[model samples]
Target: MVCITFMSTTAMAREAPIFLVAHPDVATRGLNTDTARAIFAMRQRTWPSGQAARVFVLNNNDSVHARFAKEHLAVYPHQLQLAWDRMVFSGTGQAPNLVRDQEEMRERVATTPGAIGYLEREYLDDSVQVISME
Candidate 1:
């Protein structure tokens, strides 16, 4: 019974459509997948419009984090962690700022200029802009 419940909850989270969200002040409304991937991977430091990009993320183990990683970014959570780890260890870059949950994800993205993160539809509000991924 417990196993079935956990599976279903995981299934539901995977099914939820994740939106790429950014601060309202970010100039671009859309980004190519490669650029988005680079930003999240800490390889790209600025938005196309030349704004310094600040990336936020939920905990690596969070279901929403896994879903957004695989479904939207075409990468796994473990892979992202490894990339972040490599950057941190080599002093080339740093890990993204971690938010505790979707509420925090939305709040941080909304408040920070050039911020980028993902959220489910329910957590979105006027303070952030939904960025379309091509």
Candidate 2:
């Protein structure tokens, strides 16, 4: 029973809710899944308001990165990586900036104009704006 409880708790942690956060200066309040996907995939270069969009991300192997890609962007982390790789190889685009962890993600997104990233709920604060994804 104790082992089962531990496993369940770990699973819950892995599935914790993640929010799409951006620099407070970004004017957009919400984004569709497709637009969000494009931005994270480095296909879209600017926010709806015409501000240049700068995307930040955790390492591809991070659990939070995996969860955000799957749940919010509707793509796997591997698929996103492949898209980024193709862009870089083709010299058409650049990959999102990689942050070390949620703390760094929050700090970068909060400070950089038009920056966007995802964070688990506990890391969210007024320093950034939560952009609803639908």
Candidate 3:
């Protein structure tokens, strides 16, 4: 049992310290990177469980946003912007909600139902639930 516990703990610790967080009301417990990318890219509007997903993000120039895009989503910030722009122009999709900073991101995501956004470990609080990445 001790070995099992240690293994589990170590496994969980291996995840990036940054996280995908959501309003407490969202039904999802976790998401894969592809699903996260799809949501952020505005290709998917709803969660896998059919809940409406209100996506949020920091400014494209924000270091957190850039890191999240590259390290988490395996994409570039400009690529995501271009995709959002193309979708907006073509009438197929809309951009994610933009927050001015991590503080605003925490506030908005904590209050908006079905909302999802990324944040560093330090910004976490009880208002938002961390969505473990699959």
Candidate 4:
């Protein structure tokens, strides 16, 4: 029963759709789940087209960020934080840029070049273009 419960939780994370969004000017085909995961994990520094990728995220405790992780990246919030901490401490990579909330996420992504972030359908607008998952 415990094993079943753990498996279901992992499966549910993979089953959710995580919508990826980017600044309007960043050019590329839609990203596959692996690439998106790499970017958010701070492993991939550029978009597929070779343009620098400026990754952003809300606070780890934010509900939207939590959903984005479980659904989009299929990782838990603590896992991501640990990954970031490891990278930063080792001088291997920098942590993703952070924003306070969805409102700030929209503003920063809209203005920053090569920016990538996520938002719910309702918070989306003309300022950014949604990047479809491949």
> Highest TM-score among the candidates is held by which one?
2
The lDDT per prediction is 0.94, 0.93, 0.91, 0.88
Clashes of 2: 0
lDDT of 3 by residue, 56-121 (tens): 999999878998999889999999999999999999888899999999999999999899998899
lDDT of 1 by residue, 1-134 (tens): 35543456655654668999999999999998889999999999999999999999999889899989998889999999999999999999999999999999999999999999999999989989999989
Which residue pairs collide, candidate 1?
Answer: none
Worst 10 residues of 2 by lDDT: 1-10
Candidate 2 regions exceeding 4 Å error are: 1-9, 12-14
Tens digits of lDDT, candidate 4, 1-134:
35543456666674334468899999985988889989999999999999999999999998789999888888898888998999999999999999998888889999999999998877789999999887
Residue 50, candidate 1: how far off, in angstroms? 0.8
CA lDDT, candidate 2, residue 132: 95
Candidate 4 C-alpha RMSD relative to the actual structure: 5.7
Question: Which candidate leads the pack in lDDT?
Answer: 1
Kindly give the stretch of ten consecutive residues in candidate 4 with the minimal lDDT sum.
1-10
* lDDT measured at residue 96 in model 2 versus the true structure, 0 to 100: 91
Question: Which regions of candidate 1 fall more than 4 Å away from where they truly are?
Answer: 1-14
Order the candidates by lDDT, highest first — what do you get? 1, 2, 3, 4
Q: Against the hidden true structure, what lDDT does model 4 obtain?
A: 0.88
- Per-residue error (Å), model 3, residue 45: 0.3
**Segments in model 3 whose C-alpha atoms lie over 4 Å from true places:** 1-16
lDDT of 2 at 125: 91
